[model samples]
Target: MMMRPPLVEVRGMTKRFGALTALDDVSLRLAPGAFHAILGENGAGKSTLVKCMMGYHRADAGRLLVDGQEHQVAGPRGAHHLGFGMVYQHFTLVPSMTVAENLILGRDDLPAVVAWAAERERMEAFLRRMPFRVDLDRAAGALAAGEKQKIEILKQLFLGRRVLILDEPTSVLTPDEADQILGVLRTMAREGQVTVVLITHKFREVEAFAHEVTVLRAGRRIGGGHVKDLTRGDLVAMMIPPMLAVEALTVLDDKALTAVRELSLAVGAGEILGVAGVSGNGQRELVETLAGQRSPEAGLIRVAGERYRPTRRQMRRRRVFVLPEEPLSNACVRTMTIAENLAFRNFDEPPIAVTGGFLSRRALHDRGRELIDRFKIRAAGPDASLDTLSGGNVQRTVLARELSQSPKVLVAQNPCAGLDVAATAEIRGRIMAARNAGAAVLFLSEDLDELMELADRIVVMFEGRLVYETARAAADPHVIGHSMASHL
Candidate 1:
């Protein structure tokens, strides 16, 4: 194959935030028409690298070469001029606006915020030209994880981007949704529609979607090569230094843990089943599938001894609720008022009639007030926009609604992921309370210390499969650590 000219080149890129050095002379070359995957653990340099490219952060030392010519991306606007576009894991869109308005949001050509005849017509024209498909009038806040991501991608395409950077784009999507995204990328690559680079910890995605892969560890570029030539083990080893095993959080009697070995375990009605694994395991799949977002191709799901599976209708049932890891993306509607987002989770409700079936606005307001006071949600009021609250507060608001329904099965995926030490403890306590109340809790988390403290039985998931289960007492960090790594 002939070498295509590089689209962007970073040489000796070095950056630091205050006393912490985020990038240690990391360098990467993204070639034209090639899909590149940047792989690393959380807090690694993956996000830092992308931010530097977008001019969100300035590099203390480095040279950026675009089309073989040096360029300084002073800010987001400057990056746009360079034909660079981005779709973040957390989308920024107006929830009340129609999809078409969001697709071309912030364009100066529009006189008013409302979708006019010509603008809507043009948006329709543009939508037909692109691979994105879905209803245009639907509120951005009402869309699912996958559908919302599509709007973000469409935003970039409508801006006439030649290169698109997607950050953890599939983190909240279902397996089928993820496959659809992969197909769209494949089509774009085949037709040379755009140059794409995605940042993720999921190695399988690298193999499925990227032509080349770059591994980073502790702010340094460790390796780069064709994705096909690398195994998941190879990538994991490169991303994290070799070590014997992670220490166990606690100890348990081996013989007493035998009851945990069931291939398929069942928690009685109102019982919360917890599964604790490191971040990026199958938690996303676990919650999403259980919430009816994923349709399992192999295994079976049964509720009350009847085969239960994911469907649009199932999701609307509200039987199972998920408090996703990505709070801003999944838990709350960023731009919508708290009242409006609360309604989105009411899957049990029928569609609004022509006259519009109502959620008693006053009743909802009082209920929101109660939840805010109960959960200590930091929001202005029921009318307050959810975007104004911090991540933890937003998560608490989402939790209020989920726990309100008193779901039969509640899957809280990484409930404490980005919280402070105290906040983590607080959220974990709430989860335990749910379990004590007889709710089946699938507490999927990476915090082993947490699992040791909360879950009666802890399970480890490796590469899309559950590898082992042990009593909380036997939850040695090393065993779980080994299970988390190449042992799978």
Candidate 2:
């Protein structure tokens, strides 16, 4: 009898970032034509482990075997050399470029003229296999989020990728879009196309799509086994959650806190009402409305006893600040220097016009130094591009800039998702500090653990409405879990 070869095998993989240990002797196996899911909590080693597999970060110690042969991948190109491709949470597609341009970015065989014909042929062929259809000539940026994902898929298809690593592929996708992508994945499997390593926090996704599942906690591989053998509760227990530890007696001030926080259309000033739902609930809309970025019909916003609807200018004047769920806010461009972005938020003197009509080098660098030192952000230097910073550091920069605004109401969503342990602790502390400083924090998060741990009062958001606000002590994980699932 002959033994079957595993599609990909990782053994004793370890990665360290100075004092932080992200992956510790972790290992995983992916079989051919299998949909494998990697699960973990917010600060777990899932992201780091996938990084090692993708060849973006080299493992301190590990052996990788593909098709029973050893493989050494130094970077994305090296991984591509070994027939592995990746679809990141954030895409790499150029919004202005057409689909064909993105597909044949670095291939040698397809020359400039031939590239167009070859890409178009390949794009149509791959589109036939996929569930969704996209115009091959359309600019990627104009496509919907789901359609853009199809282009990402086509890029891999053009490269003839065999093993694919998807990092939080559905985070930005709507439910319908998620369904379409998963369907395409299943079609690929039915046709014996490729193997997938899905990195996600969605518990239900594993139960539905995965053939085999691997769960990681902290920086260690805790369990790996058949998916059919586990229950949802079993999976949750495997994640090793931390205790809430909030006592009823911990409340110092509950004057504005109502037993049931009424959240119909109007909420008052100096009210730090919290919104807690499962990760993908429609909390995104409710906050955007109050933040003055999105307009709501038939809704009136009253600030400090003055009644008027929210406007961009009004939100500007009222000091309304919004902290986006994703670490990099639209306000912070990842490519720009840190000081340049930070200067915009500092909001001090008149904007200085320099020799190049850009930010003054010395002024930006000095301000960047102050913010990084003050926030303990990990950065090479003040001049470093924001993209070089880790997810945690980028988040810290955004927090520092927003908090510097000292707003009347802080409307924040998922302020700590994908952050490291130290960063998560630090960012959460800052939000609480903001509340202590008398700024009303409209905290929103899908991680019920975070919402419960940080919020003074919690409101359950299902679909697009605020359902209820349970006191921190009275909240039940099961109940919150049910409400979050209700929207779906």
Give one digit per residue, the lDDT tens place, for model 2 in 373-430.
Answer: 9888888887889889888888888887778767776778887888778888998888
Judged by lDDT against the true structure, how good is candidate 2? 0.72
lDDT of every model, 2 decimals:
0.72, 0.72
TM-score of each: 0.48, 0.48
Superposed model 2: Cα runs more than 4 Å off: 1-6, 106-115, 242-488
RMSD score of candidate 2 (Å): 20.7
Give per-residue lDDT, candidate 1, residue 46.
Answer: 93
**What is candidate 1's TM-score against the reference?**
0.48
